[model samples]
Each structure stands twice: as structure tokens, then as C-alpha cells.
Target: MADGGKVVCVTGASGYIASWIVKLLLQRGYTVRATVRDPLDAKKTEHLLALEGAKERLKLFKADLMDEGSFEQAIQGCEAVFHTASPVTFTVTDYQVELIDPAVKGTLNVLGTCTKVSSVKRVVMTSSMAAVLFPVTPLGPDYLVDESCFSDPNVCSDKKLWYVVSKTLAEDEAWRFAKENGIDLVVINPGLVLGPLLQPSLNFSVSLIADLIKDKNDTVNKNSRLVDVRDVALAHIKAYETPSANGRYIIEGPIVTINDIEKIVHEFFPELNLVDKNEASEIIPVIYKLSVEKAKSLGIEFTPTEATLRDTILSLKEKCLV
Candidate 1:
């Protein structure tokens, strides 16, 4: 589909990844209808207003993920819809209240609006790799994971992996809704999303990195599969623009351990406290490798893992968040 002059709706427009999606869309000359939890929250939305062409092309709407029909007005008459709104917390007192309900209900709400708006040809969903792979177990050597894998729902509990369960269920609901209602759908499953954030505040995932820099997380056994926020954003645009794009796409970098991150940090910014040094030196085995072959088929060349880490650290430096 042609991007120029088309109207698109981005739910959770003020979020880390969504904000970058909005910026890229506006840069390409598309009219953006952006949804925020509170439209009047200047601190949350001021950066969006300052974007290029936002004065003429950006429209802000107040919407809530838990409330049905809240996104109807913003989604009407749009050519494409990006469903990026969902809870991202790893710690929660109530899984039902804090994570699961919002993710599942919010996904259904957005898809319901898409069904009503006949003009919407495609709905690009921002699903997490947590849906495809979480509560990650040790696998046989060289065992690789692709889009076909789904995080086992049985393992989820209020005390552990609630976020994983929420995303897994929400994405399943999206696919079911699309199949039953005949809505064109595309899903993006990204791992450990990181990069320079357009929004003023730090991202939840990015905050974990900040925490790591400050010697926060003591767990040293696991490794994270990282992806640049800009690459993720571009993948969203490609998913919408490419008519042949369908099903799920995994976006990620090489998985690295906490000690690896420590080495990178010390290599880049020795001025900061050495956090990873105190952790275990044994590198986590490559239990499961994520394949990005489908994303590559769509002409998405991911940024190098070293560059991704470097840029993320540099951005954190610029924000004084490190």
C-alpha cells in the first residue's frame, strides 16, 4: 500500500516504540491519529507535538486500553492501524489487574474498531517475543526458535511470568480475531527492544539496562536477545507498506550474557561503575537461537549487535540516564 497521504492510527503513540513509529510515519507524510492515556498530559505528549509535521498531520485522542470503544473515533477512516498499546511490567501484585486483562481486552478493543472501519486494510500489531518464547528453558545445543514457537501458557503465574502470559494470550486473540473477521493482520515479535527513545522518559525495557548499569540486577545466568528500536520501527512500517507481508516476524540481535554487557560497558564507559564484573564469568550457553529469516525476506537489514549495544549506551549517556 502507498504510504503517502494515507491516514494511520497508532495506539499508545507516546510509548517508546510507538513514538518512534509515529515519528517515522509523520516523516513519510502520512496523517497520524495518535492515542494516549491522557491527551492533556503535557509531559507525556510534548515531544510528540514537537515532531516534524505534527502541527498539520498529527491528531491526538484520549483513549484507555481497558475501555471498549475508546479507540473507535481515532481509528475510523484510517487506512492502517498499529496496535502497540499494552502493559509492559515484569513485577506485579495482581496479574489480572496489572497485566493480563489490559493486554487481552485492549487487543480485542482495537481489533473491534478495525472491523467497524472498512477503510482499514491492514493492522500491524506490536507483539513481543515474550509471546513466542518466555520462561525460556534450556534446550539441546544449536536448537533454534522461529515464529512458530509459542510460550507455554500453563507456566504463567501471578508471581512469575505474568507479562509473558499476557502478551502470549493477547497475540493469540489478535490472530483469532483477524481470521474470524477477515481483517488483514501482521505481527511483529521483538526481543529485548533497545535504542535511542524519542519520548523524554525512559522505556521500561530500557530502564532494565539503566538498572544494569547501576549494578541493579544480580542474576547472571541468562542472556538477552537485543533489537534496535529503530529497526523495530522500520519493521512496523515495512509490515504495513509491503502488501505481501503476513503472519509473524521475529526481530532480534545475537543473544548476549550479563557479563558480555559488563565488558561492553567497561569498554565504552570506564568512567561509570563496573557492574558486570562482580557477576559470574561463565557465559550462558546458546540454548535457543531466534531466526530473523522472514524479516530478512522483507528486506529488513538489522543493525549489528555491537552497534545496537553501542548506540543504546550512547543514547543513555546523552539522556544522562546511565
Candidate 2:
């Protein structure tokens, strides 16, 4: 038990990252108000309730991202708000309706409720590296991507990268709203988050690794910046607790390729059949060097890639998902 009196709210409490945030907050002796679509849904709420300190410290509230004023009950009397609920999908029939609207509007709805509540002191939002990596100008290996970088909305739109565009626009809108409304907001732009899943269902990031392991035809093409899901959760808490923490923090570990992932999985689990390196497609030469000095300053020592991948595989196996 760290401190017993502090109370905070976490949106999307059933999510891969948010569930860890809720678990950690409870372990630290903070009273947690976790929001989910349906509190009665065992699949979503059961795992959260089973956390070590959940019985004494966790409370679930029903909230929807699309519904305005839905978060008022959850955020009321909370000291800090962790806004982690946003639509995440790579495929969408209507980008505006499916991805962009839910992400951008849901963010504003949460922020709007925060503005009404007097106890809300700070808001920690989970923005993705997708928001920071896709800049308009092309860069070479010499260029380093940092928190200062912004993904070009026009480019994302043109490429039909709706997920990237959604994250970028939502984060941009968050900064603008925080500035205008005087809300103390801190955003964490995390890389491809991979680690053990607290939630029962497989998330998008972990599925990428699972796909590589299970699908023999999967090819190693583009490079990816990976970060442990636990590290991302810890970063959010640190950002809120540290008074000096401000602006966006790029939370990422080493940049790796699919072949790198396949090798690691083979090293850890020899029985598992993974993608063949020889049959892999032409690897994309492009790479993004992320500057995480700001996030480290908040006392976040990133988890090693091997440990992250190992834990991820173990978790998936435990859940019988791999």
C-alpha cells in the first residue's frame, strides 16, 4: 500500500494498457474509478476485478465514448483522469464515422467532463506514436523523431491511414483544448505496445506478434518501434504524479523488424513455428530514431525488447491465444 486516500479515474479500464494502469493504481493504494461500456460484462470487467488490490480499491462505472456527459460520474471527485479510451482499428469502411469521430469526439467528451469537475487536477491521455511518426517531410536515418514532431494529417488522409490520422487529430485537439481551457494535460505517445495482456482479449499490437508467430506466410517488411505495455502504463502514472511533467512524451524502446521478433520467439519458444526469414519480403530500409529522454526524465526505464517479447509470448500462451 503506497497511499490510501488518493482517488483517480481511468477510461477504457478494460483495455490492454488501461487495465494495467488500473491494476497499478490499485497496488499503489489509490482508489480507482474505472469506466467501461458495461460493468456487468464478465469478459471485460472480470479480469479487472481479479487484480490484486481491486477488491478494496477498484470501482467500475458504465461509460461510453460516444455519449456526451457519460464520463461525469466516473470523473467526478477524481484527482486525475487517465483518458485511454479511443477507437483503435486498422480497417474501416468509413474513416470519419468509424475511427476519426469516435477518437476525436470521445476525447473531447472526456475532457469536457473533466472541465466541469472541480477535483480533476490533471489529465493523462494515451496518444499513439502514430501521431508523432508520420511527418509531412521525408527524413533519412540521420533524422531523430521526438515529441516535437507531429504527423501530417494531410498525408495520413491521402494514404488512407485512418488510425494514424485519428490519433494525430485527437492529440492535436487535446493540446489546443488544454491550452484554451487551462487544463493540465499530459500526453504519452507510445510506440507499438507489446507485453502481457491483463485483458482476456488480444489487442492489436500483441496480435501483430501472434500473427508473426502463427502465420508462416507473414513477411518481415517494415520496421517498428516497440514499447512494453507495462512501461506505457507506468509512464502515465509518473506523468500525473510529477508536477513538472508537461507536454507530450514519446514512450518507446528499441526499433525492431519482424525478423527480429521471429528470432526472439524462436529463441524463447523452440516449439513454436514462426515466419521464415529466408522467405521474408524485401525489408523497408526506412527507420525512425525516437528520442525518449523526456519520458526517461520522469523515471521510466524502458523494458528490454527481449523481456517484453518473452513476457508477451508467455502471456499469450497462458491465455491459450498463441
Best by lDDT: 2
Candidate 2 Cα errors over 4 Å, as ranges: 216-220, 279-286
Instruction: For candidate 2, write residues 22-75 as lDDT tens digits.
Output: 988887888999999999999999999999988888999999989999999999
Q: Candidate 1, residues 32-90: lDDT per residue as tens digits?
A: 99999999999889999999989999999999999999999999999999999998987
Instruction: Give the 10-residue window scoring lowest on summed lDDT in candidate 2.
Output: 216-225
Each prediction's number of clashing residue pairs: 0, 0
User: Cα deviation of 280 in candidate 1 (Å)?
Assistant: 2.3
* Pairs with backbone N, CA or C atoms under 3 Å apart (clashes), candidate 2: none
User: What lDDT does candidate 2 reach at residue 218?
Assistant: 46
